[model samples]
Structure formats: structure tokens, C-alpha cells
Target: MRRSRCLLPAVGLLLITTACQGGSSEPPRATTPGPATGTARMAADSALRWSPAVVWSGDLNSCRQGEAAATRDCLTKAMQAGGASADAVTAAGQLSSAGELAYVTAWHEQDGIGVATVAYPFRANTNEGTRLIDAGGKRIDVDTVQLDDTLRADPGVQALLNAHPQATPFAPARAAGGTPLEGGGVRLVYRTPLRECHACADVGQLQIGYDFDATRHFVGQHVVPTPAP
Candidate 1:
């Protein structure tokens, strides 16, 4: 084996050894930070708001069975903190699968539909700024209406809310002759899960009306029994 001698410099009794016969070992190759540098990756995923997971903790109480505005503020603030968007709390939506954790996840109500959160303005407000989106590319925002109907605890009526839960509120209500107005009547058409599948498919719709009085308070549910064939 052939050997090369490295030239050494000494200071006091210490020696600095430059062991290889090369001109600076390749200049350290200018490094460009990759996209996954821990901090950068974390910053990038902020839109999802996944954790401290604790940033996602707090009052996830049901908005059902309460004064509309108070219910809206309490639940929405908690849910938003818990990484839930307006849409995530709407229309059969749950914080965890099958309502697995927090307020809605830990409980159920009598004569209530377990569903995604849907909000409608109990009254009018000027919250027209766009701050969020839905599963679709279409843009929507969190407003009083979207906050109030947030039934974690959600369910909304058309033409009835100061604003509607649907992206297209002005579109005609799917229910025939049901009022979508505040203190007005509401009709909901829904299908019960035929089996115990949280993330499956089912078919069928049974509808009933929600009656409200002139004071805009929930009165009672009105059901027209299905006729046998």
C-alpha cells in the first residue's frame, strides 16, 4: 500500500492534522434547505391546525337546546380551536368518527339527529368577509348564521336564516312548502343509517317538520306518518 504524508502545523504542543490530500474536500457543497425541514413542514400544515392537539381542546358542547347566539359562540369557538372548520361541524359531521370525542363525540340527545354542524344566522349580521372554504373549491365563511346552526348540533333551514348554511342559500329550499324562515316552519328530509356503519352508504329519506312560533322559538316536531303501500 502506498501512503501520502499530510503536512501538519503545531501550536504550543497541539497539532492540527489535515489527513487527506485534497483541496478542501469539496467546498461543503452549498446546501439548499429541503421543504421538510421540521419547522417549515409544520408551518405549511398550519391550515389543518392538527396540534399541539391541545390548541384543539376546549368547550365542544352541543349547540342544541340553548339560546341560539350563546350556543353559537360557545360551540364554534371551541370547535374552531379543535381543528374543526364551519363545514366540519355541519350536516352529519363529527369531531371524530361516529362522534368519538369531546362534547358531541361523548354524547347524544333525545329526539335529535346526530349530524354535521350547520349554521344559519338566527338574525342578521355583517360578517360577509370570506375566511374559510368547504370540501368543494367554493368559498364560504363563518358567520352568525353558520355559527348558530352549528349543532355538533347542526341543522339549518332555508330562506329562514339571516343567512343559510348551504353555499347557495338563495337557491330554492328542497322541502316543499316548508318555511325556511326564522320563527317559520322547517322540513328536514333525511335517511337513517340502515346499519351501524359510520363511513358507509345508505339509501332512504324520511322527513318531518320543525315547528316554530311567532316568537321564533322551537315548538314541536310535526310528522306526517308514511302511508303503507
Candidate 2:
């Protein structure tokens, strides 16, 4: 799924009073989105879906103000910790909006589908500029890359979710916490609904984890169902 400039509403210049998570894919509704250098290039099947977001707990107070390279660098780290995809983090630094923004919203929208907000713009000085970042951010091109299309189409993924007849088509990436994996490997997380729908306030959820060896080759997967509330 691709992020839309329209779906994202304007966020006021407010201090993020609540803390957001340290960039994770759990709680499928908490993914982050940001801006891209170019329009998103996604799989043909990707379509819009419902997404709700929460503020990340990571401290970005230092990032709240400043436009210097160092400040930007600090914000970059904040975004990284905030679960922004690698590309969105990089682009956050690269973005040179003509105007200055006021504050970064604590409640970030899920990017692409209904999971995370990789990149986004706080209602700055005006309504002239707004963009998307990464969360499931999109494709295998997310933090490292968006969820690989091959994986999304993987019969295995569908099979795993087969027990749940109502899983939605939406998929959002979950960023691994800041801690590093033991063997110098990488871990990726993603989630989807147990019931299918274009939009719903809440639905059954599932968590999917992917493990890769240090060489970046696929190792295995772990799927867990989010118990109904």
C-alpha cells in the first residue's frame, strides 16, 4: 500500500505529552510513516485500508526544535527509535521544505496501509507542504526495505493466517526494538487483521516476525495472534 498526502490530516503544534514506542511493529496500529524522495512504488495488489496510530514513547524532545545538521541528526535518531523506515529516516534529513514546521505530532499515522507512519509533516507554518514516511512504511523498501512482495504473496503467510477467516488484506511493518539481535542478525515484524474490511475501528490482529541471518538470508518466521479484546 502507498501513503496518501490526503489521508494524513494536519497536526497542531503540540508537545507530544504521551510517550510512543521505540519503533516496533507490535500493536499493528502504532507504525510510523514519513516522506519519500519519490512516490511510493508498491505491488499491484496493494490498496488503501484503515489505519490508526499512537504516539511513540521514544524521547524526541531534543528533536522538537532545531534545523541544524546536528539537530536533524538527533531527529533522525528519534525517527529511527520511533520506528520510521530507514528510507524515511534518511529522507527526513534530506527533506528541505520551503517553510519551517512548528511541532512534530505525537500521534503519527500508519503509513501505506493501516499500520505505521514512516514519514509525515506536522502542520508547519502553512498548508503548502505535507508528505509520507515509512512504517510498514511499504514494500521491502521500509527501514531496510519494505516488506518484500514475494513474502506478502507467500502462500506460507496466508496459510499461517488461514485459521482466522476474517484477516484483512492490510499489512504493516514493525520495526525491531533498538536492541541488536544476538548473532548479528536482523528481525522484521509485520501485522494484519484477522477480519477483512476496508475500514473498521478494531478487528482481530496477528503478529508476524521474520528472522534473517547476518548475511541477510531469510531464516524463519513466527506468527502470533493478538488475543481478542
Candidate 3:
């Protein structure tokens, strides 16, 4: 959710892959520590369930080195902190590449609860910068006003663009061949800057995309719930 510092690079980055369709809610009171269960659990109760928080990923020793075991361990700890049942934790899978990572964790109801998958793929470096393309097809450098104007021009991506303008197209925002994963699902592509984490600095060309149904598989495709204003 926090992406202000997610600016990666400006070129030559591969794309890759989620969990719930949307962000998870805050966990309910930590009274009885057990698995979530029952048909009611299908509702994704944030009242007692923690959202899928992002543990560290994208750094050299953290994830960039293609460390499956370390990556899995990091995500597992994150899910546990978010209150995942032991079984659900066991269902987690780690998918990572040169400039991408997909951390998956399963969830279930309170008592032998049904299971659902949650995945989040972090991408870096892209061919497209925040430049704007006019109706005449002229490209414009990224500036605050110009970027806003371009997004407003497109009805389809207007709203999403407004909401996540930071994720908009940028210079050097291109990708190579994108292959489908196991389920013949939508292909993913991404790009970012040289450095991974944006802890204090900016990550320029960060782009990412995933299959349509991925959100549904992870979080149930619908409007992800948001907190009160």
C-alpha cells in the first residue's frame, strides 16, 4: 500500500507475480489462538484476522539473490505476525526472480476452516517512465500537472491512474517475453530501477502486472475493503 518510495530503475527489468484480492483487515482481539473456521470465515473477517503484511523483499540477501528459503522464511514470519494459522502458514509458497517476487500464503476459517490463497508480487525497473502521451502521440516528460492531465484523459485508466498515479507508465518502461504460469493464467511483466528497496530514496521505473483472476484467487475479486476516512 505504501509506494511513495517504491521507485526502482529505468530499464532492463523482467516482470513477475498475490494473495487476497485486496489488502486484509486488522485482526480481531487475540483471545483464542486457533485456526479460523466455518462458512462465516469466507467473509474475510478483519475483526480478528490480520491483513497480509509485506515482510522484507527486494534487497540482495533479502530476496534479489533468488533465495527461496530466506524469502519463504521472511514471508512466513510476516504471515504469522498477521495471525495466520499453522496450517495456513504451511500452505505458503515462495516465487522470486531477478527483479520480481511472489509471496503466497493460504488462509482458513476458525475451525478446520476452508482455505484461500493470498499472493503479492513485487516488481522492479520498467521501460516506461512517468512521461505522458498526448492524443497526437507526442511523449512528455513526467511533471506533476502533465502526468495528472494525461491520466485524466483516459476514461478506462483514469480512476486507477488517479488513485495509483505513482504506478503510472514511466520512461524505460518496457519488458521482455512474458510467460504464463501453471494455471494458464494471465502473464505478468514488470520493470524497476537498479536498486530494489526504496526505504529513503526513490525507485524510478517500477512497473508490475498480473493475471485478472489472481486477485480473486487470493482475496476474492471484489472491491477490497477500506478503512473509515
Candidate 4:
């Protein structure tokens, strides 16, 4: 997925809230396959079906007004407008840098597909004024590196993959919460196949956490199971 350029300015901002809680060294509970009859069977299949478009790409400037709460409200509305269930749409987390709001919603009709959305408000004052006039009034261009750029290039991601070669890979790290560790990081979750149940629709999720600093220095790593839906 292409990262939104509008959110780059908020890369330095720390997440104020996380969507997933209960961080631990333990893995998340495995999803129990529902009864293979009637509506339950249909629901399971729907959840696994991928949506052609499940992301929220609307303007988030209103989120800047009330901070996290405002962002959640905006997300709730967007999800609903996008045909999401009211109960399914929830506030997952927020970023302190740009007050970015993260949300997680699920749709069973599409085979139980889980949708995670991260919305960031634009900051005009951030990373502005490339050329500033000194006392001598000389034009000088300033070079700045965005925090998001640094985190993406951080080697910690590769290290995590190296340590766990068996992990199932998912694209575009998710923004989550509930970790006790400090620093910024990407959230990668992999699905493990169910044992002895090749036909089962439900599976387990392994969440891999990699933390980094502003300069993209590696902080630490953690592995846990994603909370059961």
C-alpha cells in the first residue's frame, strides 16, 4: 500500500493510544472455527473474503480539533459511511506526533476480513520553511528527514524477519497499542495454519513488534498473539 504523503509530517509524533491492548511475550489465542452449518458457515467465509476497497481516504482535518476523540468520531463516521457495522468500528490507537487516529473494523460478509485504518491530520507548521533568511539575509535551503522515512529504512524490520523465518508475512505494518516498550515501531502480524483442520476458516495470528528511535536506531523486539476477535 502506498503511504500517504500527508501523514509524513506526523512521523515524529508518538502514538497516544493503541488499538490492540494486552501486550505480552505470549501469543494471541487461536480463532475457534465456528460451526460448519447455516449462517455461521457463511459468516466465516465472508470474513475471509477481501474487500476491493476497505480503506478510509477522506480528509481528516477535523480530527485536529479534538485530538484523539475527534479522530475516533471521524473514523466511526467514515467506517459507517463505508458500510461498516456500527459495533464493529472502534478506536484502535492514536499518534502523538500528528494526533493520527487508528481504527479496526471487521466485516463477516466478506469472509471475516479485518480492516485497520490509520488517519493523520495535516500540520502546516511542521517541516516548513526550507529557506530561512539569516541576519545577513542570505537564502539557505534546509535539509530535513521525515521520521516516517527513517522508520521505514530502519534495519530492525529485517532483523525481526531474520529471527523468525517461519513467520507468515503481511504487508504494510499496522499501527497498534498496548506495548510497554518505548520508541516507535511497526506492527506485523502473521497467520499460522490450523493443525489437523485444513478446511477450517479460522486461524491464529502472530504479532511481531519492532521498536525504533527517531534516528531509526533499533530499540527492541517483542512477539505476541493478536487478541481474539
Candidate 5:
């Protein structure tokens, strides 16, 4: 069984509460929860200033309407290119399936920009991987992943895990409210099995997520040269 990590105290304020619109709410949208010491705590404190929110279309039923159709088309092409089409389409369908496909939007607090990450039912799969998509359903990027060496022991990831006994690397929260938050929002954290070292068999475990700030401008995805390990 995958060993569990301690969780940090759920801090900050919950501005809104509704059934988790996406698939899982285990990982908050900002940073991971775990133990932290001196400088690590300071770093996390600074990062929390950015308010983050996950956005998706409010009306899924009208997906074929407006920019929804184009978004679907772009995802279809992405699937044809060898990315996970099945999962991609399913995610798209979730918006319309629920009778609402509100154009999902996310905020990048640091840059003060809002970028649409996914519609509702945001799905993340090892087989599917990450891809670049446009508001109009254009194919812009493929098989993207982010890795960080400092995250292995970062306080943000550590403190949360330490506080909650149920927290684990690959496990979901046993309780609904036992999750971590930064400042005013939560961070969506996850792990991907990729090599982080040349000689070591370590996978590129990630703890990154999306944040949406309406004022921030969307810069194109930063192309990380490393491939999924």
C-alpha cells in the first residue's frame, strides 16, 4: 500500500462551498500540504498571498453552443495526436452532461491573469498526461508535466501531511473537510511517476495546480524540456 503523509492544518477562509464541481477536491489548487521548517515556512507564507480559484463552464448542456463546440474540437484533435482523447472528451462531456457547461476559468494569482484550465469534472490520469489547449479548442501543447526538486521537503507539502494523519501520497482524504488551504484558497496538488534523477529511479512527483485571477493575463504554458519518466 502507498504510505500516507501527515496533512497540514486547514487554514485561511473558505469563501464558497458547493459540491466539488470537478472530479476530486482532495488536492487544493495551489500548493501541497506537509511539514515545514524555517525558510520553507516563509516561502509558503509568501506564496499564499495569491488568491486562486478553479473555473469551468456553468452551463454544460450548451457545450455545442458558443465556444464550447470549438473547445470540444480542439480536444478531439489533441486526442488524435496521441494524448488521452477518451479522458479528454469525457471531461468535456461532463460539462454538457450535467446540463451545464459554464466556460471554466482559472486564475493565475501571481501574474494577475485568468486562464481557462478545464471545464468541469477536471480529470487527471497517468495514461492521459497534460496537453495544451486553447479557448477556441485549438491544439497548442502536448504531454506537459511540471517537476520540482525543492518540493520533496517543502513545508507546504510537509505541514499539511503532518497535521492530518489521513494524508498520503496517493490516497484521497478520508474526511470531506480535512484538506489544506493557502491564504484565501486551496491548492490542487498531485503526483506523476516520472524520473527526476538520471541514475536514480525516482519519479517526478509533482505538487502543482491551477489558480485563476480575473485580472491576470494568460501567458502561454511554459514548455518544460523534460519528458514524463
Candidate 6:
């Protein structure tokens, strides 16, 4: 298993203090039902909505820090430090939060092929930004609006929360990340501490799959047993 270090704030905020692991090279596998998958479908018709504006606002604030020009300068330095060519910043723009942290994303041409990178300020409160290059490093088409945001707002997610009120406390914070599907769409994941097992480190997660068009087509939930400290 791949191990990673993460920092969880009091509000259950998920933050990656170090470099993030690269994505899998293989294509996404088919969805298989797990023991917790049943309860994930408890509510199929509730209206739960996520606000892209809200997400964008948070993302902008993260990098901009109230000064647009300074944020641009930070991004320029970040891309340069990441070995990006001069033209990278030309097509780059601020993307929604990557892994829930503020980042500046830009596209670059490497050996005639297009690639994208997400850069963030270093952890030590420095002016430089560390870059997370995509695993494939393939040309990335920027989507200012992400499908995962829609998945978070899906009624199914709300329905799941209604079925299990305990999960409500972790609302918003429970939302982790979304992975793009092979066919088209994205898989939204949510992880929250188990209510009954307060003393245990076990975590319950709900994974919801949505089509490229933003339709929730699959729902699965499972409890991950705590790992050894």
C-alpha cells in the first residue's frame, strides 16, 4: 500500500502538507459492490446542491491572498521553478482547489506535447511554490468548473447524509477528492470518522460515481479500518 502523511485540522479539513502521490497509470476499474455499498443508495432522490461559485471563491482566496498581481507573481515563480518553459504561463489560469488546497495550474508544451502542472507555496512559509506534475504529464484541458463540484451537490449525497445523520457532522469536510472516470465522468469520495467508534481511528467513506454529464450513476460506501500507528 502507498503510505502518505496528511494533516487534519480541527474542522476535519484534509490538507496534504507534502508532495502528493501521482495518479495511477492504469485506467480506472469497474465498480464492484462492497459490504457498505447498500446503505450508500438509501436515498436516491434528495436534492443536494454544491456551489461552484463557493468552491471558486475559496480557491481564488487561497492563492490570491487578496492581491491578484502578487498571486500571479507567485504562480510565475512556481512554474519557472518547476522547470516549465516560458510559454506555460501564457495559457495558465487559476484552477479550483487541488486536494482542497490552493494551487495555481498551468499548461506547458514538453517536447512538442502538452502537459500541465499544479503549483503551491512551500510549507515553510516561503515565496516559492512546489509543483505537482501530473503522472502522465499529458496535455491537460483546463476546466475552470469541475464536475466533482456537481457530484458533491448531488441529491444522492444529501440522501446518503439523511439516511445517516451521523455523517452530517462531517459535511463539506468529509468531501475528499474526485477522480476522473475512464468512460466519462468523475468519482467523488468522502471520508469521515465513524460515529460509534469515537475511540477508534476507523473512517467511513462514500464514493459516488457520476457520468461526464454530471449525473450520479453509482454509489458505494465502506468503512476503512484504522491502520497501525
Which candidate leads in lDDT?
2
Whichever of 3 and 6 has more TM-score, that candidate is: 6
Candidate 2 lDDT, tens digit per residue, 8-96?
Answer: 01111111010111695533221344343123322211332212332233555665566742255566676677786544443344342
RMSD, every candidate, angstroms: 29.1, 19.0, 19.8, 24.2, 22.5, 20.7
**lDDT per residue, candidate 4, 44-118, as tens digits?**
433432232333334444454564445556655655666653323422221222554443322111111122333
Instruction: Order the candidates by lDDT, highest first.
Output: 2, 3, 6, 4, 5, 1
Indicate the TM-score of model 6.
Answer: 0.26
Residue lDDT tens for model 3, 1-229 = 4222102233222222211235967545434433443333433332222222322222223333454534656655655676655444443432333433344343222111122233433344321223222222232222112233432443433444344445443333333334444553333333433222333333333333323322222211111112213
Candidate 6 lDDT over 1-229, as tens digits, reads: 5432211222222211111115947433326654444444323112111111111111223344555433555554555566544334332333323422333343343222223344434333222221212223222222121223333354443444454444422222233455665555344433333232334342333322211213333322222222223
Q: How many clashes (backbone N, Cα, C below 3 Å) per candidate? A: 16, 49, 48, 19, 51, 2
Local accuracy by lDDT, each model: 0.28, 0.36, 0.33, 0.31, 0.31, 0.32
On TM-score, who's better, 2 or 4? 2
Q: Which of candidates 4 and 6 reaches a greater lDDT?
A: 6
lDDT string for model 1 (2-31, tens) is 332220001111111111114765333224
TM-scores for every candidate against the unseen true structure: 0.22, 0.27, 0.19, 0.21, 0.22, 0.26
Clash tally for model 1: 16
Question: Which stretches in model 4 have alpha-carbon errors above 4 Å?
Answer: 1-48, 67-71, 78-100, 103-229
Which of candidates 2 and 6 reaches a greater lDDT? 2
Give the range where candidate 1 is weakest over 10 consecutive residues by summed lDDT: 7-16
Candidate 5 lDDT, 1-229, residue by residue in tens: 5433322214211111111115955532324445534355445433322122223223333334556553555434433453343333344443333343322234332222222344333334221222223223332212233223333244443443354433333311111121233343332222332232334342223323332213222223211112222
